[model samples]
Target: MTIGATYLGDDRCDFSLWGPTLDQVTLEILTPEPQSHPLGQDDWGYWRTSLDNIPPGTRYQYRLNGDRLRPDPMSRFQPEGVHGPSAVVNQGDFSWQDEAWRGIPLEESIIYELHIGTFTAAGTFEAAISRLADLKALGITTIEIMPVAQFPGDRNWGYDGAYPFAVQNSYGGPDGLRSLVNAAHQAGLAVILDVVYNHFGPEGNYSRDFGPYFTDNYQTPWGGAINFDDAYSHGVRQFVIENALYWLREYHFDGLRLDAIHAIYDGGAKHILAELSDRLTQFNQTATYPRYLIAESDLNDVRIIRPRPDHGLGMDAQWSDDFHHSLHTLLTGEQQGYYEDFGSCQQLATAWRESFVYRWTYSPHRKRFHGSDTRDRPPSQFVICSQNHDQVGNRMLGERLSQLVSFDGLKLAAAATLLNPGIPLLFMGEEYGEDSPFLYFIDHQDADLVEAVRQGRKREFEAFHASGTPPDAASLETLKTSTLKWHKRDSGHHQILLNFYQYLIQRRNTNPAITTGDRQQIQTQYNNESRWFSVHQSQANHSIWAIFNFGETLIQSPPAPNQTWTKTLDSSESIWQGFGPTAPQTLKGSESIKIPPLTVVLYENS
Candidate 1:
């Protein structure tokens, strides 16, 4: 079926659609006035037409084979539901105020990852802006918002987004997004949006109705993979690439966190990742500030962060799940599922030495060699976090790190994450040890699909059995249990955790060694019997050491010689729940320093 359009002097309107198999196509204009126009077919089977009087703000739908009318697959705006008419949106209408805003560098970024629905009571883009000051005060350089694309319902984690181009109407639509981003920039924070390109959601996905948007060549957990290399794949790719550029050019976004790139299977001359990276680089050169791409990859392939000259995908950075797993397992001692591969002092030591835990070693849980070492790459290419959305929400019940580890352990984890070489990303409400869970919640309209989700969760955890079968995914109770208790942040234990985080962030920003981008300059020393590790970060001649005690008992470690070492930040003080003040003593040959259990200490050498 073809779509109709018309053009007038200084104002033009055109309609085009893909439906080669159909015999005829018709365009039904639903706004300004109701009218129908017959469309002409091209050699490739797409129908098109032009209307001389029609202009911007016109709403229309295309009739397939002159029969049933449907919304445009590439609709820029969807004020109504997916079944509603496509509106003509002028991308240039919104005025942006971030012309002088240069994007944040990947290495220096302190990312704050948040889901809008759960971030605030209002759960909209505008509401999120009100909280940007709090994030900025906490030293967050980038705001990584979860997906905002339109889904089937009002409540979702945004992984099930169906409309790639349209903003969720419940979240105050496109203009609301612009306002939030502009406000964030004014608050000295860059916005990095998380986008999913792997597959469309199961419900309300209508791309297939127009043309071959999916192919049977590859299968994903969601379903058939997107037709990246098949017939009409060029247009499909164009549609996605255009969407990406639209955000950068129109919305003034700083970067994008590509969601679960491993599932985006594609085999072509130029892989989609490489092409997208190249386009982003081109955009950066033309634009004022440099933009970045952060990939959420499970493959542990260093190529995701490697430079393009090395025949790599050239993403600015990638999320490091190994760091989180190692830290979480060490603190919680929960050895189930993937955590079965971790929880040893050696594992924590290895993660401290190298950013990866596996490092090409055999994983008994996976029954194979899982990952390779990323030592040669800069540490800035990896984003490390103690807790994040997936790690917390995927649990049977969304439980924050505070639930799994002690307060002392939480301090140690925060010290390790913030002072580490890689960029640090803090999950929302983690600074103050918010006790609320971030459970997997979805409000799907389809009853059968909801049942399938419930069964899927049960089956996923069936092997563990220790955590027991998770609660029904379809239950509203499960969703309610995930909401954060804002009152807890002002209380006893939670307030202490918050102070520790703030202090660590302040220390990290002031310490040159902690913020250095060069990975090769970082060194580590550990003792298997003592269950302790000390990291030395050196930039030029300046150096600082971070010591962590993983065992229950106290331990002593020698300090580096010929340096005036002072106790900069110690987690073993009475303020952090340790014994007393840890006095700094000068080192001659073997200086003894006591490290409290589950504590981290930082020393600056002059």
Candidate 2:
């Protein structure tokens, strides 16, 4: 059933609310007129009422049990804050110009993830639309936006969303999001929304008052797991599934990025991920463009991406943190916390060729043998990134790669992520090395909740043993400090870094060897003691070799492959603001080459 207000033409509207346990429900129209009407309950505990002459934009609430008033659980728009009335929105009224838009293929996706509130100074969806062309020009084929669901206040990392169906009121509500999606599709960019289904925000969540939306059967890092398998789970399941479809069908999103699937506990015969994936598959049968479901799982489990027929979760793809961890530990030499399991050239090479560094191997962090072999899975099933929100913001100080690593190290990291076999995802400003940190921020109305969040952040960083107090997550200054500086991309070394990123992306797209996405044709080797790693990829008769030196001093490398090679890209070249073109331009058998410190060099068979 369509929960919340559904605007029918001719100034009529139908409102439905799922109040399984309530003895009574009264529709109270708070705007345009003051009126109340009793709703009829069906066999399944859903109350429904239709009103004539109730036009769109009518603000209303539900009087539950004839006493307490609550906003619609599936509110489409919250004109006021989450504590205020929900507005009736006519979703069909918006004009979309994306009839000819077909979504980008998963294999060809170069995603750029951004937080709308921080992407621009205006901090609105419409403001974000002005920068879509900039991303398209940067070779970004897809835009993965952080969650836009309604929260208590405007500032947040989006995980604290409370109303699953309502567009954020502070971010311009439903119409603002629709306009952004429409503009993005017209700009030849596929837009995917990041959704948090594991837990609702601490504040403004009123679903429990209506029904059993959460259960104590299982516990999550946040609190009780969602009631996916408990009593009345059928209704809960449908509510979540319909929300996923609503975004794809109503808003015309290309896909959804499931946030932290590892925390979404479900012990049912049909896992929720598999069920959601099956629904997406069914939707794709007749969809104008394919819709995808990408999962963010830390389990390192291939079953998440494995086919449903094969008894797997059937996610289209999953983020592979092994690649990021390996690259990060190697570049920064950080050996504490989770980074303990990484920091070797061998692991970095393994992640490049195998997609998972801990494939049935011992993990010191977990003190157990973890992960399964993904050799049977294609490389496109994984998404790799050098730096993401979690990696940067989770730190006590929220330092970005531009702040932690040297300029040469940044270039090497970019090349490794872009040229790897898996799909590449770029964080908001990493392409031009934005120095601002992506700190975790939130705006909650409750004073106790604010203190709890501030303390939670401090305790979470205990492992890092970082000095200095973390920026208050509830402060407006923290959000402002996290905003990206757009002008930085056009000046001095930052501009050069931008050029280097463009060149690497172009090579990854046009070059046959790098574009194949074939793991079988790739070979990786590294010397742990020498701190050198090499990836050799080939497709048909075309081949490319990338040699990386993570050491601080120049090192000598053996001869090139049997065939002669011509230099293509050297991160240490003067074009990229490097000191010199230290590596030789051409190489053949019986000739060793000198590699500069903290540099990456590429060669194509001539």
Backbone clashes in each candidate structure, one number apiece?
7, 0
Which residue pairs show collisions in model 2?
none
**TM per candidate:** 0.93, 0.98
What C-alpha lDDT do the candidate models reach, one value each?
A: 0.79, 0.90
Best by TM-score: 2
Candidate 2 local lDDT, 1-606, one digit each (tens) = 687789988889988888788899999998899899999999887899889878889989998998899999889987777899998999899999999999999989999999989999999999999999999899999999999999888888888888888889888888899999999999999999999899988898899889999998878888878989888888788889999999999999999999999988888899888899998999999999899999999899999999999889989999999999999999999998889999999999999988999888999999999998998898989999999889998888789999999999999999999988798999999999999999989999999999999888787777578777899898999999999999999998899999999999998887778855678889887888889998888888888888999999887775666777888899888888887877788887557788889989998873
Give the runs in model 2 whose Cα sits over 4 Å from its true position.
Answer: 589-591
Task: Compose the digit string of candidate 1's lDDT tens values, residues 132-212.
Answer: 887887788999999988776777888888878777778888789989999998888999999989999888777777778
> What's every prediction's RMSD, in angstroms?
2.9, 1.3
lDDT of 1: 0.79
Error of 1 at 382 (Å): 0.7
